[model samples]
Target: MASTLNTQLHSISFAAFILQEIMGNPREDETPQSRLKQVGMMSVLYIMHQGHQPLTISNLVEITKLTRMGVSEVIEPLIARGMLTETFVKNSMGRGKARQFAISEEIFEKLQSFQMR
Candidate 1:
């Protein structure tokens, strides 16, 4: 129906608006390095926000379709900048270690305030 088409159009428009805001608007606190890292880290966080659990480098590689090295390159800086946090745990098999990555409260708050314009 016309109403359904209208609703679908509105949804697409809103998605485009959010993408534009994310790509175009930089917060005053964001540095050039942070901005670059944000592109990758935000993709990671958006995945987590969508109910994915136990976020790890491996999971990020799978979700983002990037190589492990590529994901690590993105994650290391985010960790250093305190925009993301990592926790280590013993593997279930007790044969190795695993790391879980999550967005920091500060970054989450700042991201929440980004205008959707």
Candidate 2:
């Protein structure tokens, strides 16, 4: 019971920290698109933090209920920021390979330290 509660608390705080970093300073000219982007980024980060396995874009789209394009948009930025790492999955039965994403090791370590606070 205690372990479950601690895990829940860590997840919640981890999500909050991600939101704070993504939201940064609010501007007077915030628009619907900007807000949606922020939420999408946060959702991706939160999911990556909680999941032990790397995920494909299709998996993220299904989990977050975001469109394929929306997930792609957020994921690119996360990758560029060094917050996420992308690895290719070989498709033995298919023509093309799929990319898998996971939280970067540095960021994951930081998250663990943050949760301890």
Candidate 3:
């Protein structure tokens, strides 16, 4: 019972932290498109954050319900921010497939701090 409660609490707090980061008090000049982009990126980060596998754009699109273009817009900026990095790998057919992305260690550490506070 205690373990279940702890798990639920952790989930709630983590979701709140993610929301606070992505939806941070909206700015006066922030446009709907810009806000959507931010939310899209945060949704990708939150899903890919499990650290199980380097997730591909298709995976994020399917999970987050965002269009390919939308994911592309946000992912590029996240990479620029150094919070995410990609690794390209060829498939069995030796064709260049979409790259996979993982949260940088620095970003993961920052998330840990959010968990703490």
Candidate 4:
């Protein structure tokens, strides 16, 4: 009985090893579309998750460590695609207004589906 149990344990361990090898390390794809969405989504999520407040372009730039141009590039496409909604907020600093960006639920759902596949 002990020998049989030992054999079964080894078989289970071997199966786990095989499964890990087959699965490899799951990494996000760096395709252009995926990369854009990833940066945008992560930046949005980080702000929402951390700040629990509205997000501005400057907020996104700070959170994502992306340049103003980079953030604008990603945001323009998202706006054109209707994947995000933007609202202008009065800047307390009194220099210029800021735009708060939110991801549309429709786009969020689509991204979730894409990640599942």
Highest TM-score: which candidate? 2
Candidate 2 structure lDDT: 0.69
lDDT of 4 by residue, 1-117 (tens): 987886555444433432342234323433456444544454464446345756677877777798987777667655554646788878869788888877566644654454356
**Best by lDDT, which number?**
2
Q: Quick one: ranking by TM-score, best first? A: 2, 3, 1, 4
> Model 4 misses residue 56 by how many Å?
0.9
Each prediction's TM-score against the native? 0.57, 0.70, 0.61, 0.50
lDDT of all predictions, in order shown? 0.64, 0.69, 0.66, 0.57
In model 3, which residue pairs have backbone atoms overlapping below 3 Å? none
Question: Model 2: clashing residue pairs?
Answer: none
Q: 8, model 1: CA deviation in Å?
A: 16
Q: List candidate 4 segments past 4 Å from native.
A: 1-51, 105-117
Candidate 1: what lDDT? 0.64
lDDT of 2 at 102: 74
Each model's number of backbone clashes?
0, 0, 0, 0
Give the per-residue lDDT of model 1 (tens digit) for 1-117: 987886555445444543454457766666666556656566556557547576787777778898988778777765765656899977657789988777677654544454233
So what's the TM-score on candidate 4?
Answer: 0.50
Residue lDDT tens for model 3, 1-117: 988886666556655654565467555655667756765565556656654644777777787788988678777755765657888876435776767777677755765686678
